[model samples]
Target chain A: MIIVKIGGNILDNPERLQAFLLDFAQMPGPKVLVHGGGKIASALGQKLGITPKMVEGRRITDAETLDLVTMVYGGLVNKNVVAKLQALGCNAIGLTGADANIIPAQKRPVREIDYGFAGDVAGPESINADALEFMLEAGLTPVFAPLTHDTKGSMLNTNADTIASVLATALAHKYKVQLVYSFEKKGVLQDAADDASVIPYITAGKYKLLKETGVVNAGMVPKLDNAFAALQQGVAQVLICEGEALPSINTRQYSGTTLSLN
Target chain B: MIIVKIGGNILDNPERLQAFLLDFAQMPGPKVLVHGGGKIASALGQKLGITPKMVEGRRITDAETLDLVTMVYGGLVNKNVVAKLQALGCNAIGLTGADANIIPAQKRPVREIDYGFAGDVAGPESINADALEFMLEAGLTPVFAPLTHDTKGSMLNTNADTIASVLATALAHKYKVQLVYSFEKKGVLQDAADDASVIPYITAGKYKLLKETGVVNAGMVPKLDNAFAALQQGVAQVLICEGEALPSINTRQYSGTTLSLN
Candidate 1:
């Protein structure tokens, strides 16, 4: 099974997203899609007189923002993807972690900062893998929005990357899962300015050396950390690639950064 | 099997919705919930400067309104209900018609009036009864939003009442289906303003006499018509009642207007 995560960049582009969904529909075997909110929420927020509040470059998921993301991520984006996938002959189901109590999380605790309604997944062990497995075995593709629920009746904002990573790690026990983090770039680039400077492969040792040399861009750091974490937690394969390059991943001729344990 | 549909009156009130959900959760056996968008969409639209357009009291679902309903109905209302139901120990899965291609529809054609993205279900036979039965037998309760999708990849604004009726009529073939249309009122009333004048039972003959005598409210005509349509299409029972009275129906002590073929 493959768990693929796409960020706002791909979601905001119609042609690219349609192209990605076509490739995704064609990919053999069972798969799950996790998507980010993109600019739609923020843009809609501004129109509704709710200016977004960001702290340390991370969004504060206040009551209004939680509703905003739930509408955009859970409703608009998720449904659109499912509809498009259905058009491509894939039986897709849109979901939030709350749907089947699939991915229960704790409301992020307040420390130096209050992230408001943001959620933190306890670990891979917390996921309802059985329900997910049932859907997969039923020939359904699950398209998840980046939202989870607390047991106490609240929908919490969650990170899309974390959702994809956690799902991959949890489902690893049942199937050999390949986790893909797809974005606009072709792969993890050695240089920030050049798209052609793609790193073909990175092991733990190589990543450490790249970090020491300061070759990895700041934006790619968190994604790489998540990739490495998912790999450590037993996910069979991890790839950082362009959205259009999804089909190649299935063919094992992927032109992206493939991460593995060393 | 029971298919209960609740409208905006119950949905807009937090206390009423919670109380109704509690009653609904305690009702034994397989059940499905269908909900309507309340004032949230209109309020949100007002904030975003998208003044709603209506013709003959029916809101025109332009592209913007379609997106608005998708957000409010499918996202805000549906997920909150699912989360709340989950908190109450009901394994609720929130869905729109597009999710599993469970309720496919066509865009309303332009006649004298173009309803824009409005959807009309092609009767009960068009519903995916097998998929719905699968969910019900899996111990999952499906909470649906008043939205359907065209096969060509567009989500259409659907009437919650129609969705509920269609579902009940379709599932009646496999189960002893009881269709319930729940709202703020207790039941069909003898007088428009009297709460105590609840009509306990009505048949096709009784409905015609009530219509001729002007005893039935004009607003309730469509609902009664849908109810009768469902019964004609093979639904075992049809009830129009207060959302709070859900549990009473399970025990055969319902204080609602029960409809039947005479």
Candidate 2:
């Protein structure tokens, strides 16, 4: 089974999302949805006078910002996605971290550096894999909003990437399924400027060297880290590439960046 | 055991972080860390003429912003925290999501609404909790940056709060620990205008009520969300209170907001 996660951007693009989801539902083992709605949330936040702050690409949620996120990520975005899936003839369940206890988080210690009302993953322990599997078995896709719970019954923010990696690894561990990291890019470029020159594969030793030499820069740094990490552990294989280009990842096939322990 | 996550603002006030780490190291529990550094990241981004885009509180990391985050969250901030921990009588290791396979993630799909270069939690796989537990066993504290991994060998932006929640839950599940959501004010204010009105306990039903009719307001939304998530699953209890109080989450003491399942 290949576990597929569509980004919030994809979800935002109705045409693309509908097309992608339609294709995804037709030929899939278990498809779990992880998404973003930063645009919607931030737009609303700014309109509401909450100064939006961010580090890198992740938003720094303050108390006000967090409220905007819930309305968008949990309320607007989550329900709309579920509705779309239902319209597509797919049985989709909309989940906020609160439902069935999916994502549990910890409150970050306060500091002069206020990230506003943001939170982190204390544990994705609440991910009901059994429920997810059941959805898949029953031909239903679970469209998950990045809303998780903490022990105290509060919902928290989550990174779609972290959740996807967790589910992919967890599901892979549970069943030897392949984890696919789909995006708009072709794959990890040998040279970022040259997207066509994909770095088909890299060994752990080389990965370290690449970092040491500084060829690995910016966001690419962490992506490679997780890719290598998955290989070190046991996750069958991980494929990173543009979603529009292919249906599935097979080492033999001509497509995205593939990472494997082999 | 309790996992104390110092915020990036603590970095702004080195002396404060140093002081907190001194006590945190001495406090009891199997601990892991998750932190943020938006204040520093944004300052540099502005100097570089990058008008850091935020969707909600999250940043949309493009190539340039990513570099800035690496420097702030991964380099200076991470190192500074480590240095402080060392001085505070704690054996602390500084890490980004790239190291030790902690927090693997993936790029969000390109939403029609651009969160700039921002990312959200997709999956939270591959945290080396064994190493964390090993550190806790040896009384070593792990100082973490909020950076996470994409399926590629790239670094994706992750919110600190999300990071803390994930780490708290992960460590708690593995080693059995308590979590504290300390801030600068009274914990979980029943009324935002009145910080002293801390709610010692909350439930799912109560949380919904809080969200309605304006009690849950803005910032506390995600904070409360993540807190509830952790409590629902593995965390023994989650306390939301003032960070300056330090090492004490007692609800009766008016230290911070203490959340319970009851």
lDDT of each: 0.90, 0.61
For model 1, residues A67-116, the per-residue Cα lDDT tens digits are: 99989888988888888998898899999999989999999999978999
**Candidate 2 residue lDDT tens string, B1-262:** 7766656556567667666666676765556556677476676556557786666665567776765675456644554455445444454555545443445555677766554334455433345455456545655466667766553435567777777777777776665656766576666777777876877777768888889978777877988888788777677777666566665554355566566667
Q: List pairs with backbone clashes in candidate 1.
A: none
Chain B, model 2, TM-score against the native? 0.88
Tens digits of lDDT, candidate 1, B1-262:
8999998889889999999999888878999999988899999888887889988777799999888888888888888999999999999999999998899999998887889999989988999887888888889999999999997788999999999999999999999999999967899988777987899999999999998898886888898989998888899999889988888885678898899988
Query: Which regions of candidate 2 fall more than 4 Å away from where they truly are?
Result: A1-262, B55-58, B116-119, B122-128, B250-254
Say what the interface RMSD of candidate 2 is: 18.4
Q: Provide the clashing-pair count of each candidate structure.
A: 0, 107
The CAPRI class of candidate 1 is high
Q: How many clashing residue pairs are found in candidate 2?
A: 107
